[model samples]
Every structure is written in C-alpha cells, then in structure tokens.
Target chain A: MHIAFDPRLRVAGPLQALDARCKVLAFFALVACAASVPAPSWRAPVAFLGAATLLLLVSRIPLGAALRRLLFLVPVVLALAAVVPFAKAAGGEKVALWTGGPMVPRQGLLVLWNVSSKALVGLLCAIILAGTTGVPRLLEAFERLCVPRVLVLTMSFIHRYAITMQEELARMKRARDARGWRGRWIWQAGTLGSMAGTLFLRSYERGERVWQAMLARGYRGKLIGPSSAPLRLLDVMFVVWMLAAGLAIRFLVR
Target chain B: MTAPAIRVSALTFRYPDGTRALDDVSLEVAPGERVALLGANGAGKSTLLLSLNGLCDPGGRVEIGGTPVGSRNLPEIRRRVGLVFQNPDDQLFCPTLFDDVAFGPRNLGLGEEEVQKRVHEALHRVDLATLEEKPSFHLSYGQKKRAALATVLSMQPEVLALDEPTSALHPRARREMIALLRTLSCALVVATHDLEMARELCPRAVVMARGRIVATGETSVVLADTKAMDEAELL
Candidate 1:
C-alpha cells in the first residue's frame, strides 16, 4: 500500500505538496470538464489540454515524459473510436489505402483526433494525480470526500494486498519455472485454473484471519477512523483556485 | 477474594468446522503478572487466547477482569482484554499508523481528544512516534509488530494477550520486543516457542498440549523440567 507501483508515471513535483483532497477534487473536476463536450469542439478540449499542460509546467514536472506516455495509449483510443469516422461517415468522400479493408474516410481522421485528444487529456490528469499522491493518502482523501466506507475500505485492502498477490503469483511462476513448465495458456489450462483456485482460497483464508484480528480490536462493524482535522488554508486555497480556473477556462473556451 | 486479571475455568472450544481446538482448559493470571503460554504447533494455544475475550465462543467460563465473556459483556471484555494476533499484517489493516493505533480507543467511544492522546502515548511507548503518518504496509516487519502492539496498548487493556509476538523477528528485534514487554504494566500472556524469551520477560509459565494444560508453574521451573518439556513437545 505504501509502495504505489501503479504502472503510471507520476512526476513528484510541486503538485505533490498540496493536500491529497485538493488534488482529488481538482483533477476529478478536470475529468468532468474534459468529458462534457457535446461534440468535437476544439475550444473546450484544447483549453483543457492547455490548462493541464500549464499545471504540469507550473508544478515543475517534466512535460515531455508525460506526453511520451500519451504515445502508448494513442493506438488504444484509435482502435476504439477510429471506426466511428469510417463506419458512420455520410460518405461524401473516401481515400484509398495501400493495404486496407475499408476505404479511409476524411471525416474519420478528424474524429480520431477528436476522440484521442479527449482520452489523452483524461488519462494524463489521472496519471498526474496517482503519480503524486500515495495510495494511503488517496484513500484518506476518499474518506474525507464522504465516499462510502465499504468502497473506501475495499480500495484500501486492494492497495494493501495487491503486492502480496503479486508476490504470490511470482512465487507460483518461479515454482513452475523450476519444474521446466513453460506454460501455454491453452496447453496448461488445468494447472493454471488450479493455481487460480489455490490463490483464491489463500486470499479468502487471509481475509478470515484479518477479520478475526479486527474483531479482537473491538471492531463493531462501524469503522472508527481518526477524526479528520479541518481543511487547512492551503487545501482550501488550492481547491478554490483550481475550480475557478477550470470553470473559467471552460466557459471562456465555450 | 480479588478477581484475577484473566480467568478461564473448564473452558472448551471447538471450531465451527468441527475441530476440537481446546478441551477443559483452566488457567488464571494474577494482576500485573507476566505469563508465558508455551506449546507446540496444533496445541490450541491460539484458540485458547481467542476464547479469552469471546472471539471464539467458549463452552465453559472465560472472564476478563471479573466480567464474563458473552455478547452482553463482550464490548467491556474486549476493551479490558487486548489480543494481538500472530501476524502484524492481520492486525494492521488501517491506512496509517495513527489510525491503526487509535482504532481501539475510538472503538471504546472515547472523545477525539482522548483518542489522539492515547494514540500518541501508545506510539511513544512503542518508540514509533515518528511513523504516525506512515502507511501500515510501508512499515518494516519489526516496526509493524511494534505498531500492532501499540494498537492494542492504546485501549489500556488490563490484560494483554500476545500470540507468538517474536515468531518472525530477528534476534535483535526479538530482544527489543522483550525489552518493550518488560516495561508494560498489564497482565501479559505471551504464547511463544522462545523459552529463553519466556524466561527473560515472564515470571510464570503455562504449557499446553493437545488442547489441555499439561503444566503450570514459575517460568524457570516449567522451562527447566526436561521430562515435562518433552511430554508437551515444546522442544
């Protein structure tokens, strides 16, 4: 839980200094703003892209690295939304490709750009938030935001045991490797299935033991959290500033 | 007659799945007495501890500070009897060290101020005051063990039940745990295979075998007798 090894880039910059609650609210607000475009209007999205870039720059984080990350997911966005242009086009025109099943439509390229840019913006914002805040801090932030305790606790447990689960997988892999069992998923279906079942049972037993520990500590179903202190001046300032700036840019761009 | 810190009389506990874990076990620890529960694997040492404060329902009597371990008095019993599990990972499920330490006191319905004070005191006692904001998973094994103990200590229990406290610790960490145990004033019941540690910290000893108490006496005496130790499979 402490070691956040989410396969995402997080440049620990000035943004990491603000309280996690502020980061959660501001970035999630950014997510909402990015998602609200009725159609591909460059103004609203480009404004968001510019704001996000400025945020990265002001935080003293490197922009090129984050932008480079956007490269990896570009194909995914294209795969999902690229068909919209080709399949749904009114067919006023089409361009032939050297090797293709469907003729390349001119409208498809614009649609590709439109879909990708939005997806990139949303993902980058998430990466920035996760990169900066530790999972425990993020969970605390979730608690402060009045998220349901069950959901919060679930995330917290997932964060805590994810590494444990990974380690278990690694151990199983090692054991398999030791026995010269280079597994093809189809060929070793039974072995893999059994492994998954064993892991589930191990995890289930661990959960039972953890629950017993909680009971010993007087856990009465209601989670007793450390009382949260009032929001600090810096936290308040960061949230207000981000909300105002994001809303203002959205309106001005519109 | 004064009530013992912990009392179990003819207690028997069987797991729901039908394993008889404990059988007619009777034991008592006087106030402020440090007792080592010595036993081998599958000896029901853990089951007996679980029954002490009603985590496992006992067939016979189990009491903490004169209060019976039942649903009506479980809340009070749990508060007075803190059970630290064998694995720190099992006990420390909270996000941060502060929250984990404050958990017990907060459950007791203490005020925020009191909870904070107790959490601070517990951390200070364990010499982990600096790690209050650290995630429980981030802590080293030794630190997590100490943090787990602090979680129980925050409630200021009259009797502290520790299950294999030094099981996974290195020699230095084990010695440190012993030192920490030496300072605490509660009635301590430590179940351990480390006879050396039991002799160092606990003055009294109770040896369990096959869900029954095979021997009970001064720590040195119980640990000294080779025939009894052999019979109990402690060695």
Candidate 2:
C-alpha cells in the first residue's frame, strides 16, 4: 500500500540525466527481449542480466536497494515454481535426490530455471528504470509516447495524493489509539471496517475538492500540455543501442 | 469607474442532499481590491468561492472581468479567477512542484519557455524555487501551502479566491503567507478566520451567515460591528 516517498532518490544522476522516454523505451525493449530469449541456453539470459547490472552501475543506484526490492518477489516466484521440480513433465528425465525419495523431473527443473531467469531479468530492468526516473518524468514520458491522457493523469494524481492519504490514515489511527478502549476480535473488525468507510468518504470529499481545483485552473476535460523538451541526442543513442542489443539477443544469439 | 474584477449577484446554491450552501449571495470586488470572506464553519464561505469560479452547478450570476461565468466562458473565467482551496493537496494535483506551479500557465496554452519562466517566477515569489523539481508530497505543510499559492499565482489571474490560506501553518509561516498575499496586485477574496490577516492584507470584508452575505464594508468597520459579528456568530 505504500512505496517510498523519498525525493532524494530522484535528484540528478547519470541515468536520471537521460530523457525519460529514452529510459522507458530502452528498459522496455530490454525486458521484452529478455523475456523472449530462447530457452536451453544461458548465453542470452546471462547477457540480459549483465546489461541490467550495467544499468544499475551507470545509474549509480544502490545495488542493495535494488536487491532488497527483488527480495520481496523471491517468495512469490518460489511459490509459483516450487512444484516444478517435483512434478513430472511429458518426455522428461528423472534424477534421484536420495535412495528412496521420489525422483525429480529434469524437464521441470529446466522449465523452472527458464522461468526464474527470465523473470529476474525483467524485474531487474524494471527496478533500474523505476529507480532512475521520477514519477513526474515517467508521466511526461507516457504522455509524449501518446499513451492515453486519462491514464497518465490518473497516475499523476494518485502519486501526488498518496502521501496525503497515508497521513490521513495515520491521523485516524492515532485518534483511535488515544481512546484507550480495549480491543477484542469483535471491536477490531467493526473498528477497522468503520475506519475504512470513513477513509472512503474522506477520500471522496477530497476528490470533489480536487476536481473543483482542477476546474478552477482551466482544466477542460483534458490535461494541459506536458511541455517536455524534445528527446536529446543522448536519448536517441541510448534507445538505439538498447534496441539493437535487444534485437541481437532475440535473433542473432541463437 | 471600470467594472468590478469579480461580480456576484443573487448567487444561490444548494447541495443535492437538500442543504442550502449559499442563499442569494451578492458581492463585488473592484480591480486590485482585497476582500475578506469571514464566516464560521458551514457558513458557506467555500461554497461561495466555488460559485465564483463557476464550479457550482448552474444557478448563479458570476462575472469575471465583465465576462459572465457560464459553460462556454468557464475556462476564461477560471483562468482569470484563481481559487486556492483550503487544502493544499486539493489545489496541487501535480506530482512535482514545478508541474503544480506551471499547471495554470500550461492550461492557458503558454509556450514551454513561457511556462518555465512563469513557474520560476511563481516559485521564487513563494521562495520555493530550490524545491521546484521536488515532488509536492515531499514538501512540508507550509511549503505545500506556499506551493499551492504558487499554483494559483502562475495563472496571473486578475482575481484570486483563497480558502483558509493560513489555516494549517505555523505563526511564522502564517506571517510569511500574509506578506506573500500582500505583494500580489490582483483583486483577492480570501475566505478565512485570520482577522489579523484580513486586517493586514484585505482592506474590505464581507461576512456570511446562513448562506447569505450578512455584512460588507471596510475591514476595520466590519470587524468593529459587534452586533453583526454577534449575529453571524463569528465571535
């Protein structure tokens, strides 16, 4: 429900200096190619991972931070692929882990490997992209890319007010805690439910005020111009190099 | 002489739930005049501000710069009448301080360079220039308030409508906010309880009660009217 609201992370950096559109396109292409890399070989996947690491180093993003975020997904990926090595697959070879235990399927293990590697590469590329670009910059990039205006504006507002919403919730919780009322199972459910209801109404009222504010600033159904600068030569070069690397991995590396 | 920068005549508004928020409110603000809208909570101060910007559902006479507030004229009227809402979060819906400040000018269809210039000027006026690229959520309450004001100031509106600009700030920040409002040359209608602020920044005052304009005169004179203040329950 909460992401870091840290503004210090978005200050000028090597990757932040690149245009948002370039980073978006480059990272997106890298993810797509990484996802499409043919299985049965470690070459493409290794290259994709190397490129992601290169981006992290160049962006000066903390590897620790990226790895920490990646850790959140470990359990999810593990859950999805947990049964793979245990389940038998068609035309699969079996290997014995111990003398009496059920055999592990070789094809299932390979499949799990392929799935986990691709996911890692895709996740790393995304982490790097997000770590480098600010939400405002990302929205502008989306607008310049001809994404739907309503979607871009929705994301912008959500990002803008999320902290406010968090603060409101925190205030409500504090008020609740100060009453010194003992909470049991019955009280807990009712209190939490009512709290949610109150939050919904408060958010709705804030939405009305925000809408009025938007109208007061001459918003005529559509948001105003993004007013971003043209993509620079560095941006073009970055995209070109990334797309080329992606295409090479997808087509030539085989 | 010239027409009032903002003219409201018999402006009545009611919520869908059958609560009347405004009742035939009539007021006018001459060019460059500063007016305070004083009322207790639920006195319809904010409702009247909404009506002035034509954000209320149709049934009111509102004019900005001699232009009527209507469906077609809404954009022009809105651009001319910059309304800073009570909550900075409401007024600032942009991710970055720069975007929030430039929103008005961008809506006005100004060029990129012009938008940048106006944004810089507005932020400088609010002393938020160093934090222009920072996300608004990253700002403190006072910074957010000033940034919200900058959002309206960037429009270069002929008239400004502020709802409790000094509500959530510290004493020092409140003083700074008043000084910032005092520097602007446009006609202003600030709905607030800051009497000292009204006295210092706004020369004229109008008090509302039961959704109607109960008193209107010089700030000193209106503030001195004990009977009117008592009836309005502003004490």
Candidate 3:
C-alpha cells in the first residue's frame, strides 16, 4: 500500500501563491489554541472548526479531498475516546469496581468530546497546511522561520524518499505474492516484520550511498540553497489576518 | 602532464563479514582518459569505483594524482572526483532539483551567486535547464538521471566516476548521456556491462571478475577478446 502524501496536492497554483512560513505559523498557533481550551467547552471547538473550515474553503482546495485527509485520523481518535467512559466513575467520587455502584464518571464523556474535537480540529489545520504547500517550500519556510538546519534537512530527505520506500515495499510484497506464500493474520504480521527489516536495511544502504554522492559534490555537512523569494507584504498581511481572527475568536468572542 | 590522474596499487578490500570485494587490483588512468569498467553482476566494478572517491576503504593502497587516499586528502579527492551512483533516486536526495544540483557547490562554501551560477551551468550542461524548480520525484526517469548527472557536474570534478549510468535509461536518453559524457574534458571511469556503450564512448576497457582484473587495454581489443570476456562473464 502506498503511504506517501499525494503529489498533486503540492503542485504550484493557488496554494503556492501564499507564503509557507505564514501558513505553518498560523496552523501551529491555531492547533495550540485549540488544544489549550478545556474539553467541557464546546464553543471553543466549534469556533476553531468553523475557522478551519473557512480557511479550507478560501484556499480553493476540494472539500472532498480535505475531508478525506481529515477522516484518516477519525478511527484512531475514536478508539482512544471509546474507553474514557468505562475507565472513570461517573460521579465526582470514585467507587470500587467490583462493588455495585455507578463507577463511570459523567465528566469522562465531556473529556472524550474535548479530546476528539481538539484532535480533529488540529488535524484539519495540519492537513490544510500540508495540502497547500509542497514539501520543499515547507522546508524552506521552516528554515526561514529559524528551524534547525539539521531538522529541515532530515525532513526534506524523508519526504523525498518516503515514496521510494513505499515502492520498495510494494515490490517486495509482489515478490512474496508471486511465491504463493499467502497466510493468516499472524503469518502476515511476520511477513510485514521481515519486510520492515528489509526496508530498514535497504534505506540504510541507500543513505550511505547518498552521503557518498554528497561528498563527491563537495558536501561538508551543511545544506545550502539558492536565495529564496523574500516574504512579501501580502504574506505578512495574511499572517496578521489569521492571528487576528484566531485571537478574536479565542479571547473576544467569549 | 604530470602523474596519472588516478592510481590503484595492489588494492584489496573485504566487507565486514570477510567477503572479499576487491583483490590485488592495480591500474592507472591519465588525464582526460575515458575508461570503461566492464563486468557482469557481482564483478566488484562498483566497489572499485567507490574506492576512487574514498567511499569504500581499500585497505590503504589507492591514490589520486599521486596523493595516497587518506582522511587528510579525502575532501580534496572527493572534490576532484564526481561519483554518480546507479540510482538517481539515491543520488538526488534533496527535495528539489535546484537544491540537489546546488548541494555540492553549497557544501564547498561557495557564495550564493556562485552556487546559482554553477547550478544553472550544470543543468544547462545536462540539458535540464527548464527543470530547475521542479521536485525530483515528479520528474520522469530520464529527467531524474539527467538531474542526477547535473548534481555531480555542478562540482566540476576533474575526474567523473559513474556506476551503471545508463542502466535504465531510454534509448534517446542513453544517446544523450553518451553525447554529454563525450563533450566533457574530465577523466571518465564508467562501470557497466553495456559493451555497446563501452565500445562507443571509451577508448580503454578493463575486465573485472570476482574482484580481480582479468584484462585491460584498448577498448576494441580487450572487448574483442572472446575467451577473456567469457571467463569474466561479460560476453
């Protein structure tokens, strides 16, 4: 199965028009604000979700694609949220589990709602940002934002090669299937583990070869790039508007 | 005009698990010589190429321009020898084609203007000038290979070491690569089983098998030696 982020989402057009640093900071700030509000307050989450939806609509990305990406996180959040009510007692006071008592807490449902909504909103913001910006532009933006060069370099390589690794995995799976080695769930797990091991080794070898190639070109442990386009006044204005709207929602709306 | 550009003497190597990869190999190439290393699979051709740039340890018996391969001379040696790996995906690790081509020059601490100049020149050399801003992954295989070549060429190395440079290239792309390599003045060492390519592009040929050099001479004679070619599995 392909695990790579879609490339079509990264093509330059409407999304490329906006500065990457602005989008990253804005998304991050929104996520932090979304996470900080108490779970019991539904109004904050509703406001955050509404803001994210508005941004998505204005960005001109297809609504279906955005929702599809957001949907990927639903199962995980739901699984984590499922156990909340059963784990805690409903009343403020806890009672023995084996004894006859209403052990589940009423606040547990509120906590679950809070966690799920925050996670969904946070994920939505991230998806929108990633969908708009290509990986290289995003890395360049991070570098401009003063992110450590090593981290930027690492993420850049990861984004470039993740698809290659996925292709390698697909090839291995095809080879295994050709050998007629179909099996049950546990056997499949074993096969997957071996595939993971092989992928790791191959990636490690590729890493060495890439480094050697780098050295051949006079690489000295530091990454360098061309002079990027300077942030325009419009990019600054975009950031100001996003921050203002976010702050207005958080502090003023209440 | 001076010493041979590359010198290898009694070069031997073994992997960590003790599998001998190269054995008692000795050779030399003068400046501007285009040499093809012809071998079948598992012939240790790549191992030898890697040794030229200090990517592989040769147990202390390899030299470039009369200077022995060592930690002290490695950076200088690497700057002089551009090694293009078989896979473009592995070689072009940077996110964008521009960054990948500029990587080597940037690492050399060149100014941003110089880096851009080299990147443009290298891309122009490989006929990839229009793809400066494209991501590496989005390019077709032929384009990726050309970009990979540009990545190394930007460094302007005196010696170019290529491993399977045309293995998966289309016919047109292969022709383009051979033409490009011919126009370059640097000493070229290409390791491949493509006898046709060797016949067309290189004046000299080396036959390798099981980590040993079986024959080396004028490309036509060495490649025409049926018995030696058979023994080395090149034929």
* Residue runs of model 1 more than 4 Å from their true location after superposition: A1-23, A56-78, A92-103, A130-146, A170-194, A222-226, A232-237, B72-75, B94-99, B102-121, B127-140, B224-228
Runs of candidate 2 exceeding 4 Å displacement: A1-5, A39-43, A86-91, A96-102, A174-190, A221-226, A252-254
Per-model C-alpha lDDT, please?
Answer: 0.81, 0.82, 0.80
List model 2 lDDT by residue over A72-168, tens digit each.
Answer: 7698678867777766555667877688877778767666776787888887877777778766677778888898988997976776567557767
| Chain A TM-score by candidate, in order | 0.74, 0.81, 0.81
- Candidate 1 at residue A97, lDDT? 51
Tell me how far the alpha carbon of residue A101 in candidate 3 is from the true structure, in angstroms, after superposition.
20
Query: Among these predicted structures, which one has the highest TM-score?
Result: 2
- Residue A228's lDDT within candidate 3 is 65
List each candidate's DockQ score. 0.55, 0.69, 0.54
Candidate 1 local Cα displacement, residue A170, angstroms: 4.8
Misplaced by over 4 Å in model 3 are A1-5, A11-15, A85-89, A92-107, A140-157, A174-197, B1-3, B65-69, B111-117, B130-140, B169-173
Per-residue error for A101 in candidate 2, Å, reads: 6.1
* Candidate 3 per-residue C-alpha lDDT over A1-254 given as tens digits, one digit per residue, 9 for 90 to 100: 11125654554455458788887887787777778776557677788889888877776666777777777887887797668765665357444445686555656766777788888888777777877875656776888889998998788667656766766777788999999878767757788888889998887777677667767676665455555667888887777777777777777554
Pairs that collide in candidate 3 are: A89-A103, A89-A104, A89-A105, A90-A104, A90-A105, A90-A106
What is candidate 2's lDDT per residue for B1-235, written digit by digit as tens? 7988988888888889988899988888999999999988888999988888888864678888888888887878888998998889787766578888888898888998999999999999999999998878778999999999999899899999999999979999999999989999999999998888999998899998889888999999999998878878878
**Worst lDDT 10-window in candidate 3 chain A:** A1-10
Q: Name the best candidate (by DockQ).
A: 2
